[model samples]
Target: MSAVRENNPVLTAIQAAHPVLADDLPPLQAVDVAELAAMDFKPRQPLLSPWLCSQDLAMVFAPRGVGKTHFGLAVAFAVATGGPFARWQAPAARKVLYLDGELPGAVIQQRLWMHCPDVDPAPGYLRIFTPDLVTEGRTLPDLSTYEGQAVIDAMIETDTALVVVDNLSAWARSGRENEAESWHPIADWLLSLRRRGIAVLLVHHAGKGGQQRGTSKREDLLDVVIGLSRPKDYDPQQGAVFVVEFSKARNLVGDQAESIELELVVADDRATWRCRTVEASTFERVVDLANEGLRPNDIALELDINKSSVSRHLNKARANGLIKADKAARS
Candidate 1:
C-alpha cells in the first residue's frame, strides 16, 4: 500500500496532507537530499536552449486571414515533431498536442501534413484535438475528469514538450473579445501547465486595430507574445505572406525591432515557407497606400513608387489588412 501510494505523487501528497490522514499516517520523513547546490534555476537563453529551461507561455495574435492558424500550425509541428522554427533551433524530439477550437480536424491535418510531410499522429505523438473536449462550466477544466485530465496525463505520460491551442476566442466562455478580465482564468490555467516543463502556445486573434483581443490579461500572464501581420505588400491570389514579429518575451530578448517576411507555397501536397527581406522604406509606403484604400496604380503614382512595388505592397497589406478595402456597396 505504501509503495502503491508513493507511485502516484499528486494523490499521495493530497491524501497525506489531509487532516483526517494526519493523525493515523506515519510522520513524513525527509528523503535523502541530492546535490541541490548544483541545480541551476536561472532564466535560460532563448535562442540556444532546449525545453526552454522552463515552459514558455506565448500568445500569438493576428487578425483573421493573416495566416495566424497556418503560422501556428507550422510552429506547433516544428516544436512537437522537432525542427527549426523562425529563430529557435530544433530541440530533442518531443510530442506535441494541438488543441484547436476553430479549425476542424481535417483542416488541422492538412496544415500539419503540408508543413511536416514526415510527421505522424498516433497514441502519443503529434495529436490534434479539435474542440472535442467538453470544458464547459469550468474556467479551465480540471483534467480530473477523464476527458479533461486525459490530455494532461497523456502529455506527462508521453513527456509532451509542446501543447498548442489555436485561437483564444473559440473557448472563451464570455465570447467578448474586448473583455480582458474574462480571459484571466483561461490564461492562468494555461500558464499553470508550464510548471511541468512543457511549453504552451495559445493562438489568438488581435483586434482589427492591431491590439490583441483581451490583450491585457492574456499578455500579462504569458511569457512571450508573438504577433503575425500580413505584409502590407502581399497579394491574396498569388500567395500568402506574413510579417512575423515578437511583441513580448520575459525570459528571452524581445525581438521588437526584428521582423521576418515569410511566404507560403504549396505543391505536391506539401507546403513550404521561405523567409524574405523587405526594404523598410518601400514597405512603409505600401502600408500608406493600403490605409488610404488607393488602387495599385494610384498608389504607385501617388508615391512615385514602381507599380510592381505598389502591387506587392498592396497584396501584402490586403492579406494582412494593414489596409482594408471598402465594400463595393459602401463605396
Candidate 2:
C-alpha cells in the first residue's frame, strides 16, 4: 500500500527501529597514523645481498644469446644453496622455482650439470617447470586464465620463495608489450605476488636502443632492472664474456650501480661453464672490441673516445698480450 517498500526486510526493520541511527554510523574505517608508525616492522632479507631483496620484483633484460638465462640460473643456484654469485653474496639458502618458457628439458639439464657438476643435486631446493613438462602436451599456461591460477597454486604448494619467469614475452598472454594498458593485468598479478612475500624475476629481451623491450610502465613496477650485453668484440672461442649493468635499482646506493663483467670459463672437456667476475676497464673494452672484428676507428667511435686514445689502449693491450692485432690493423 505504501509503494511496496521494495521487499527489503533488513532496511524495513532498520527504518522502523531507528529512523535517525543510519546518520550516526561512520562511512569508512579509520586508522591512526601515529599508531601505525609505532608498530614494529622487520627488515626484508636480502636474496642477493645489497642488490635484490626478498619479495622484490626485478627484471634481467638482454639481447638474444647474451647469456641472460645463464646469469639468471647462476643467481638462482646461489639463492638455493646460500652460495655466492658474481660479486654478490647470498645471505641464506632459500627455495627457488624456475618457470622455463624456453629451452627444452634436456638442454636445461645439461646447462645445470655444466654449472653444478661438483655439487650434488639437492631436490626441492631448486625446482624447474618447463612448458613442455608442466602442461604435458597442452598449451602453455596463460597468466590471464585458469592456467595462471594453477601456476600460483603450484608455487604455494611448493613453498616457493623466489620464482623466475624465464621470459616475460613467452609467459605473458594477451600482453601487448608496447601498450601500457596491456601490461596492467600482468603487472598487478606480479605485484600481488610481491605483496605475499614472494620474489619474482622476469627475463626479457632488450630493444635495439639497449633498453628493455616494452612499455616503460614495466620498469615502473620493478625494483631492480639489470641489463646483460656482450662486449662489442665478444669472441666465442676465447670465452663467453658479458656485462651485467644495474640500470635501475631501488635499494642500491652510490657506486653500488657499477657494472660487472662476467666470463664463462669451460673445462678442456667443455663439460662445465663456470661464471666468474672479471675486472672492467678501458683496456678490456678495447681488447673486446678488437676481438669482435671492429677496426680501431670503429672501436673509438663505439667507446666514444679519440682515435689516438683507441690506438694507445690498443698498443697497451697488444703489449700486454691482451689482444692480437691483425697485419691489416698495423698497416
Candidate 3:
C-alpha cells in the first residue's frame, strides 16, 4: 500500500506473514563517518573550569546532613550569577534549573538568602522547581515515563544550560539503587541531555561504608564524581567544615586532582554565610601517620596542629578509605 511495501516484495511477504513484525521494526538513522568528520564541531566549554564542562554528567554524593544540598545550591548560584565557586570560575552567567525533591521552598529560600544576602533575586537566571511543581498533575520524572519526558521538554523549552537534580534517590522511582540494570534507563536519559548540549549534576547519597549507595554503573558515563564528608570532630558552633574530594575527574591532571576542605563561615552578626576553601593535606598527613602506627595525640603534636584537627582528619581519612584501623589502633 506504501512505496516501501511496494518496492520491497520480500519485506512485504514477511510483513504479510507476521503483521506484528512490521510494527516492531525501527526506523534507520545512519550517518557517514567521513561526512561527520568534515563538519565543524564545537570544542568543549566549561561550566566550572577543571570541574564541570558543558555536556557533562556529573555526580556529587555525600552522607545525610553533610551540606550536599547547600553546596549544590551555591554552585548553581555561582553558575547563574557568573561568579567563582570555591576556586573555580564560571565562564559566564548562565540559566540554571534546579529540581528540588528534598527541601521545601521556604527552607531553600532561607538557605539561598543566607548565602547571598545582597544578591537581587533573578528569577530568569536561577529557576527552582520543587517536587510538587514537577509532579503537579502527572507522575514523578523517572526517566522512563511520560512525566520524565515532560521534564526534559521543559528544560529544552526554557533553554536551560545546566540542570541540577537535588537528589537521585528521591526521583529515581522503582529502581533499586544497588542493581546495575536499574541505572540503564536513567543513564540513557542523561546521555540524551548531553547530546542536546545540556550539563547535568546529580546529587546522591553515600552508603554506610562511605561509597556511593548504588552500583558503580552510574559513574561509567559521568565526567566527574565528587564526595563530601564532615570532619570527625565536627562542632555545630564552629561553623560547618567538610572535605570535598574529586574521586573521579576526567578533565583534571596531576596536582589538580587534590581534594580541598570547604568551610561555611558565618559573619560576626550571623546574617550571612560564606563558603571558603582550605587545604586538606592535614587530613592526608593524619591518615599517613595513623597508618604508620602513631596515636592521634602523637600525630597532633608531630603535625603541630590541635588534637581536634588530628582527630577530625583521622576520621575523614578512615571514612574515605585512605586508611584502615590497625591492630595497635583498634585496641
TM-score of each: 0.64, 0.76, 0.73
Native RMSD of candidate 3 (Å): 10.3
Order the candidates by lDDT, highest first.
2, 3, 1
Question: Residue 308's C-alpha lDDT in candidate 3?
Answer: 80
Q: Could you give me the TM-score of model 3 versus the true structure?
A: 0.73
Give the clashing residue pairs of candidate 2, or none. 233-292
- Number of backbone-clashing residue pairs for each candidate, in the order shown: 13, 1, 0
Worst ten in a row by lDDT for model 2? 269-278
For model 3, residues 1-331, the per-residue Cα lDDT tens digits are 6887688644543444332465578876777999888878656687877788888899999998888887888778888887776777888878888887777767877776766535543678888777556445765566544346445454453357788988888768666889999887777668767877889999999999998898988898899999998755456776567878899999999767777777776664233334344445576667878888898778877777888877777667776777765511531
Q: lDDT values of the candidates? A: 0.62, 0.75, 0.74
What residue pairs clash in candidate 3, if any at all? none
For 102-154, candidate 1 gives per-residue lDDT tens digits of 66557766776788736543446677666544357633423223233333444
Alpha-carbon runs more than 4 Å astray in model 1: 1-53, 118-123, 132-158, 175-177, 251-257, 280-331
Order of quality (TM-score): 2, 3, 1
Q: Which structure is stronger by lDDT: 1 or 3?
A: 3
